[model samples]
Target: MSLTSTEKCAAAEELIAGGKLEDAEFLLEQVLDSHPLNVTALNAKCGLLMRSGKMAEAKRLLQIASDIAPEDPVVLTNLANVALLENRIGDAIDSLEQAHGARPDYLAAILLLGQVHQMLGQRKEAAEWLTRASALQAEDPDVLAAGAAFELDQQNIVEARRLYEKAVETRPDHIRSLAGLARIRCLAGDFDKAVELAKKAHLLAPQDPESALVLAQVFFQSGALGDADKLIGRFKRRYADYAPIVLLGAEIRIAQGEVQQGLADVAAWFRKAPGDAARLVAFLKLLGKAGDWQRILDMCEKLPAEVRASDAVVSLQEEALLALGRTKEGWQSWARRRNLSGESPCPPVQVTLPPRAPLLDEMVLMRFVDAVARNGRLEVSGETQIPGMWERLSAAASVDWAREAAPDPQLLADLAARATLHAPENGGFRAYLAPEPGRRAMWEAALPSDGRPRVGVFWDARPPGLLIDHLQDALQDLNIHIISLQFDESRHQLRTWRGVLDAGVKLEGPGDLVNLVDCLDLVVGPDGVPLHVAGALGRRGIALLQENHEWYWAGSDRQSIWYPDVERIVLPIGPSWAGAKPALRETLERIVPALHLPVTT
Candidate 1:
């Protein structure tokens, strides 16, 4: 039997919903041919075009439908969808808003508007639209779940939890609501509940990557490496091209000591999305950890000029050059750290110091020098005997102790242009300051002769986040003599480890801190002044880093340009230090073997 135009349009929608796009398109075209002004047929044809990835044709059909029925909410909403697909965000927003204005209670338009606002990073507007949608459809599971997801994005945890719970209550098997709740629980460190919720969501939709990702993250963060690995393997098989899954898998593999495999995974991810700066930096870091200096330099050189000149890329390049023992090239690259604004120009100034005067004011002068010194134009009067002076001096300009020259017009012009003029580029800067004879003699005399390794320890950095007690307890079993290099607020932690420390070493009022640090076999501590001092004095050290560390600790590379001999042990991302314990233990084990100390315990 033949069907009427309206009947054919209805049949087309059923066909489209049943996944028969070709049949639906043919039916919709016949309906539109007979009834060109039929908004329903026009909208259906636009949906079919969109589903088939013919965005331009979809938009044209949507426009025709909108013209035929200017006040039709469905036609307006479909047009907005077409606009969004085309990346015309502003047009999508305008269309959606107009649809909502035409029919204030249209739940679909309200929901779409909420999503579009969220996509534009307008969370407040998204919340308003979502709230209105919820009001319009009080029992809609999708609306409740979307509202909960929006709350989660805004970090309104308590409200998000409430909304997600309500959504689950309304529809027990809502996958997104369950996943939303699971994410909150995971972030709150309630891994057990998070696992339970995520598992339930995964069971409901086993192939859903979002649910699986949440579950995998919960497992990894809870230290269930085996479960996380299994989940990651499944995800890789199911969604091989998924970037987050690939990155997470790489991290898990690296943490499991499959360094080469993990590195390969990271490189593969970068190849897939080469323009992602964060991932590119991550790949370069993995290459560095593998000690592939040649590859690091080569990969860096091959990067687009803009990417190569970025701060992160430049920093990695500097580290690779320094690691390869190319000091001059490394220093030249390191000078790129100066991010200058062209608006203001400051002329290079050579501060002349009277004899018997301090070379530069330690407190105020260093800050200014660090900010303005470029290319080597900021010259000092002469070399000073001050113990910590050389380190700061080298950062600005190389000292010409014997042949002093006046600051010329060329130097001033270079400084005015904010050119790289740091003196370290001259290749003659000393790594450590020359300590006074008396201070050096005192430190040498106080050196420990106990056949055991002398390890310097500093347990604090102003905003404290160190595992001091745990570190002290762990060190108690090692056969090494501890020297406390702590000063200022760090001195308080000394009482906590006094029982295990040797009483012969005098830490109180020890003058010339650099000379003292230079005498130690190795320094180990969190990011702090003592670590910096050790690095400056050309001493070997171990730096304990938190996940959110200073910019100097760029990438996963253990090497630092400021402290070439220092190795970094970065803690995993989390609120607690539990994840870091294993890495710390492994580092200590490596250090003991390198120091030629027998494994005592």
Candidate 2:
């Protein structure tokens, strides 16, 4: 007569929430042993399994629970959770809708529906669903916290602060609300108040990792890297199994310039929990940051098929392949770049973009805009959010950016069809862009008549200063004239050098730059605009790829398929540029000799 099965099940749910998984399993088993088909016991056990990185097993239990009670709100909600854990986002929404239909007053399903819609960037729908939930349960702290989180994600600070304030008033001990309010204060640049609120939350629940994480993040953001590191170290000892704590600690260490240690921590976490999508994503991202693309590809091949095929992992794998010069395969997988960033709008739940097309991709839309302008007049049916972009486009071309409030289905369809940039073998036109006639004439007049080779040097974006220094040194001694086409602060480096003309000093735009590139025998460095312009014009050039080279330069070892006239010199990845000297010399010997002007290595 100690307790009924229902009471035990309820106790088990509390245990699961408290991180007492072993005790929860014991209680669930006791209830299940007495009643094998008990949905509550099954759901409770499944939650424990899922928390421990056993998604497949948890799904089996959830399926059994669902079969027994098809219309049970908890069962359907748990089913949605299982789908979410496995990255089946569409299936998750379907289950959530079913859960809400089964029990119209179920708060969890309503909040989850709102959360999922927001994750997909469907703000209007998310607001409507969250509004319904808030209207029904105004006093519930959970409901208020959910509303606050959605507002905070979109930077609606006023609304978010109000909701967080209300939630905190309802339950002062609520760690999530406290942490959220602290974040809002931090975003407002009120560091002192952020620290006070976070510290209060941490003191109330010392074991709660969310409180600790918010405090550490606040410290990190406030330029207190040392304090953040110390706090993270303290939290890591007690909350080693907590995913957010581990990730946040690693992030703090990285901010402190302890990147090697941070990478080790994330890599170790992945080794221990490869099933965790967040761990995999963190590991790959850190590896990329360290310019270790080779290691990423190696790790991907070793992982289990399920883990390898994860949306996050696959995106990184494609990036690694592209960085390592695997072009054809990378471009074949290029349409999935939208999935490269798996956005998690909510904590502990991975929300990803759908792999299908017709999403509002501004990058592709811009490309279309550019193409339309070059050809004739353009019609921009959909609205754009980029400041001053439409005005600029309208200035350049006869564009109508004043029609529909949202993107037409036709615009999305066009974006989907024209996503790929690769020129299919024997089909699409490969070279069409050319320099403006007047600008090209100006650059031609600016060139010297000394009969020496014209070399245009530009190191934009990730400027390898030392590498460019060495390259220019070798070129100056040779029978060639150097022209500095670098328009940014990097152009200052060439000021002291004598007899070097500055063509990019006051250029108007890319058109002027393209004309400068047209005058040079070679245009060099990690520049996207100049390189593509030179390639389109069938110009010969030497490309110095960056630590993380873009996908267009993929699968190119000796020469580019996109521009066979240009040769690729893949610069070594990482901070040190010393190793690239010998590689650069070899490329110079191979390509420069053909310039036919008495070149000696």
Candidate 3:
């Protein structure tokens, strides 16, 4: 018996549900050939075309179906899908809303509307639609997965995990649910479980790049570099022009110790995406690390003015200038850069009278005077000399005191203006100081008669934690008596190194810093207050730096303008501190011989 048109349409729907897309397409075409206005046949054919990735043909058929059955919810929903694929978000929303109006219980349309709103970043509207869909079909795996995706986007990770788990339980082989779970696991630092779930998703849908990418990232984070490298290699071959894959490939190369090649890959990305400011900054940092001062300067010049004036860019520029031996130009550039921050200028205020006793306020006022004098603006009118302040400040600023008058009100105002212009945000007011007589006396009285060279060491900064013990171990092998200049909360870290080396002496407080710094043969540490103090005191020092160090340690050169007596050694990029051991050893080897010290080992 021959089937009727309606029966053929129902049979085609069944074929589609049974995964026989070709058979369904043939039956729908036969029906449509006879009944050109048949909504069911048109909708079915549109869905089949969509499933085959023929979006243009699917859109044409969906339009025909909508025209034939103006009130058909299924037809509207299919039309919405076509609109969405064409990037017509408003059209998609209108179609989905019309579908819901046509048949209020249309679960597919409700779910799609929710997903569309989510994609548009309308979180509140998306939640409303998703809540309605969930109420309508509480046990639907698709609904559960969609809800999980919303939760994930909102960063409600716990709820997302629960929803995804329920989805996978409902439909054990759901690829999206598995992938979602894998992503959550990866973020939670459970790489082992993340890899397992990601592998399962990849196995189920081998062509899906998301699952493969997730698996590769899991391997990378878990320190399985070989696995990540292999997977990334395959992805590069298969998805050669994929941007995310290319970026990950570059990172993987860097992790594998191909620093220059990896940097070149990043540079290629920068060339392709010139307008990405973050990427440009990252590229400049890599150039700085490679000691490519010319390239750093050239790239900074190419940047937009606003970007070029940014703190990171200006810092790199400063480094490049100083490295190129343009010290005067670099200092002037730094002064100008400091003035660009748009902060209100400091008010010209009169200096307050010094406190009768040697109080903290008096010391602060004295330091302020010292800063004023260093700027070459001090005009002392009276013979009330503040001990060593005038001579120290004048010497540090490289100005001759004989050419200038003593400190006065006008001089104080000029100092205030220059201080406001040149003072760093951290208040690093390059004030000159003679060693405190009292602290010097105590230190001299306690000095051991053995006459071993004293090296001052401090390690740690505000962020970017370092392996201080490794540094100490390297230093301990140098046959020198070490002195701990570490203070503040980080001094607690010293306990770990004490037993491994000779019990080195330590500074008692901040007061001892001046005398102690003046006492040391050399200071070595991460760029911080100790190094700054050593530099100010004219002591030779070595600064261990990460790749993206602060602006003060500008340039790739061994020397700094802020600390002319100090040299810098920068660690490799990517695994910066992790790769510092060899660099530190090599630098210390050169430095020890240059210092004319006997090598113990």
Candidates in order: C-alpha RMSD to true structure: 14.3, 11.9, 14.3
Reference-based TM-score of each model: 0.42, 0.52, 0.44
Q: Compared with the true structure, what per-residue lDDT tens digits does model 2 show for residues 1-601?
A: 6889999999987766555677888988898888989988998888788666566778788889889998898888888876664445677889889989888989989999998888666889999988889889877887898889997987667888898899888777677788899999898768889999988877765544557789988887776767887887876775455556677777666544456887889778777756666557777877775557889889888988987887778888877766676644554564454433222111111111112222223422343344434445544444333323234332244444544433322243233223233223212224434566786788798787577778776663222223346556556565677787776555776755667787778766555665677787877655355665666567777777644555446444667755566677765543345445667666766766566555644
lDDT of each: 0.65, 0.66, 0.66
Candidate 2 — worst ten consecutive residues by lDDT sum?
A: 344-353
lDDT tens readout by residue for model 1, 155-223: 667888888889889778788789888889987768789999989887765655667788887787776
- Among all windows of 10 consecutive residues in model 1, the one with the lowest summed lDDT is 408-417
- Alpha-carbon lDDT of model 2: 0.66
Where model 1 places Cα greater than 4 Å from the true spot, the runs are 1-197, 200-204, 263-297, 303-339, 342-601
lDDT of 3 at 371: 55
Residue 363, model 2: lDDT of: 26
**Model 3 residue 166 lDDT?**
95
